[model samples]
Target: MVVKRLSALKRFLIGRPLKSNELGEQKLNKTKALAILSSDALSSVAYGPEQILIVLVTLSAAAFWYSIPIAVGVLVLLSALILSYRQIIFAYPHGGGAYVVSKENLGMNYGLVAGGSLLVDYILTVAVSVSAGTDAITSAFPSLHPYTVVIAIVFVLLITTLNLRGVTESASILAYPVYLFVLALFILIGVGIYNILTGHVSPELHTPVGTPVAGISLFLLLKAFASGSSALTGVEAISNAIPNFKDPAPNNASKTLMAMGTLLALLFTGIVFMAYYYGVAPQAKVTVVSQIAEQTFGRNFMYYFIQGTTALILILAANTGYSAFPLLAVNLAKDKFIPRMFTVRGDRLGYSNGIIILGVCSILLILVFKGQTEHLIPLYAVGVFIPFTLSQTGMIFKWVREKPSGWMPKLIINSIGALISLIVTIMFFLTKFAQVWPVLIFLPIIIYIFYRIKKHYLAVGDQLRLTTCEPAMPIEGNVIIVPVAGITHVVENSLNYAKSLNPHQVIAVYVPFERQEENDFEAKWMKWQPDVRLVTLYSPYRSIIQPLLKFVDTVQRKASESNYQVTVVIPQFIPKKGWHNILHNQSGLVIRTKLLYRRKVIVTTVPYHLTK
Candidate 1:
């Protein structure tokens, strides 16, 4: 009944099992795909620019002046990645994520590097996005700050469950919030721009750019670019999920990628410019974006509206990782690089195992870091850049080799992208190595784990190989021995079934603790005078399994000489109510488990299901 109730809850939450024919119906069109797949990139703007100021504000007041340059660099790189991935969408056209691209062009080792990085990134994406979204909530209601970790974990759980309902359904559920967020942010930017032109500002608008700061250096500006790279983290999700798009999947995916890149660049640049103009700094608790909204829109409905939508979109951004991670896991599993269970489609046709794993990992990260977005950001940036570098470098090689129409220009563009990304990756780690060291330590370990999984898969496949279809020799005789505790209706039912097997003999074996009880059982057996023979044994040590093993070995030794096979049949009584099982000791389970490993002995169970 408990299992049935859980199953019903699952069906109610995720809908009914999707038939194979219904898979086509689950594909996303452009609008839904953009909302579902682009959430990560689109939502990153909420914190991406703030991350840059976080690094620069430590330098000096003048260091804030470099944010525009960093934003420009990010936008340029975003453009390159968009074009490079558009080529990838058409070139491979089956959702050519970095892992697939690197595996195909660079080799398996490089592919594993890309795959591992992405795995870490997607997990961190959920962690960081959830934490950041929760931060937005705390920004509005400061009293809720203590529950940040709890709220982030609950948000992850919700997104994980929603994704398990299948792709299209999740997209449809999330589209409205994403659209509302877009509308609210643009309105803030518009009204903020108007206020700036009119020379009117709120009292919250005045704040220092920096204090007690170090001088800005060339290295500091580069570090700022690395910090702002959070904006680019989710851009690869579209390439990973091309197959989820509607008819002409590649074209639709490429368009979605283009749309996402453009929006991300615009929002990231706008937020940074407005923060600078308004002198919004990194607060101890609230975000700079919140400060800007309050300064421009005041503490009115629009102010709360933007904060609410920001929180919604940031949580929805986690949906981007939710969509990509399972698909990447499935691709890796299909290639035998990961556990095959990752490839199993749930009742709703989603990669349910992968989704649940992603959720659990994100929850752990949230709890470990106490849902601090700043701490989570460095971890996200490091993982994201490695895959970004590999994917672009692979694309350059792909274009160079293929030399399709206009391949030279595409090659040149991806080459520039590869170089910039490689620089950012090196600089990102060098600047943020302290926070990223844990990930670096785990990457190779994860790679080795996947290798071990593949090895285990191959070893099992080898053992399961069949050399011949039928048995080499046939059994001359068969004996059925039923394991009995005492004479009961369950045991009697088992004995009758053993007799029906038409074996050479049917015997009931019992191991008793005391001679008095053995005698009493013997007397009862004699009085019953059933057709089966009763064999009794004594165990002074009170060990049932040891005595049973000895009896079985003796029977097998005698039977083997006559070319006979042995069968041990145990009767099991199953209670109707689940709690009733707790009322009874499971000796039947113990006997079956112990005798299963013996050679030349087959164990069969007869279940006597109780009506009451």
Candidate 2:
């Protein structure tokens, strides 16, 4: 009854189970695919420019003007990544992204490095995006600032539930908010631009001036560039999930990738340019986008609308992680680098285990970092850029090896992408090493674990292989043993089942706490004795399973001398109510658990149902 109620609740939450035939229906069209796959990259504009200004402002207020050049730098990186991943989409349409590209072209070790990095990146994407979304909420309602961690976790759970409803369903639900956010940002940018051109707003009046902490240096500019490059974090997601698209999956996925890249470039560039023109700087309480919205529209409906949609899109950006992580895990699982459970689809035809695990891990990051976006940001891009480097490098190898038409162009594109990605990865590591050291430590450990899991699976396969084994032959005889607590209906049921086995011998064994009880039990057993022999053992330590195990071993040794197999049958009573289970001793359960690993011993349970 309890199981039935729980199953009903699951159906209500996740919708009805999807059949295998319905799986194709779950594939997304390009529009919904864009929303699900690109939300992370699109929404990063909300914070990416601000992250640049954050580093620049540390030098002096005047450094805010440097944001345009840094934004251009990030844009260049974004373009290279887009082109490189498009190549990946066409080459490996079944998807696995960097893991597949690296493993096939480079080697297994490099592939594990890429896989581990992307897995870590996806986890951080959920953590950072949701936390940033929560920041948007608190920016609109300062009163909610104190509950940041709670709000972030709530958004994580909400996105997790939506994704668990199946990919197509979640894409439909999440698509509109993404479009709304794009409209909001475009409006803000257009209005801000009109105001600037018409002399309604001036940079001199609104720009902030800060105390100069240090003079601008090459290191400072590279740090700012690295921070802003986070805008490129989600570009690989489309390539990672080509199979999630509808028919002509690879072509559809490539179109979505192009659309996402164009929108991301426009949005990211517009936001950064607006921030510069409006003289906006990062604030402790409000976001740069929120600040720009307020300045462009005042504290009006438009300002609130921008904040609302920004929060929504940022939260949904985690859908990218939700969409990609499970697919990547499935790839790793198939290769025996992770648990095979991740390969199983759930009731809704989604990778439920991976989704839930991602959600839980994201929630832990939120709690650890107290849902602070800035705190989590330092650890964010390192994981992503490492894979970007490996992927482009792998592509370089592929183009050189395959040398298809236009291979030189492909090789050059990936070469440039690889060099830039390698540089950005180093910059992130050097600049944010204090905060991101944990990720650096974690990557090697995870790669090692992947190797260990592969080794274990290989060992298990070797042991289970049938080719080296001899053919089976029937046993000469069977010896059955039944353990009884008392002369009850449950015992009778078990004894009957043992006799039905037609064994060469059947023995009923009982352990008693006291010697007197043992003698009494033996006398009673002799009188009530069916056709089976009765054995009574006094347990001086008052342990039931241990004494029974000793007697079973003794019987097995004697039976083996005659080429007989041993079987133990125990009786268990089924309680009428779930709570009634607490009233019973559960010795049968304990015996079954203890005997599970006993070599060549067969154990079976005979259950007697209790009505009351």
lDDT of each: 0.87, 0.91
> Per-residue lDDT for 461-576 in model 2, tens only?
97777975455546898988899999999999988889889733888889999999988888888888756888888888999988899888888888778878889998998998
TM per prediction: 0.93, 0.96
Candidate 1, residue 420: the lDDT equals: 85
* Number of colliding residue pairs in model 1: 0
Off by over 4 Å in 1: 201-214, 467-473, 526-537, 549-564, 594-601
Residue pairs with backbone atoms closer than 3 Å in model 1 (clashes) = none
> Whole-model lDDT for model 2 versus the true structure?
0.91
Judging by TM-score against the true structure, name the best candidate: 2
Error of 2 at 10 (Å): 1.3
Candidate 1 least-lDDT 10 residues? 203-212
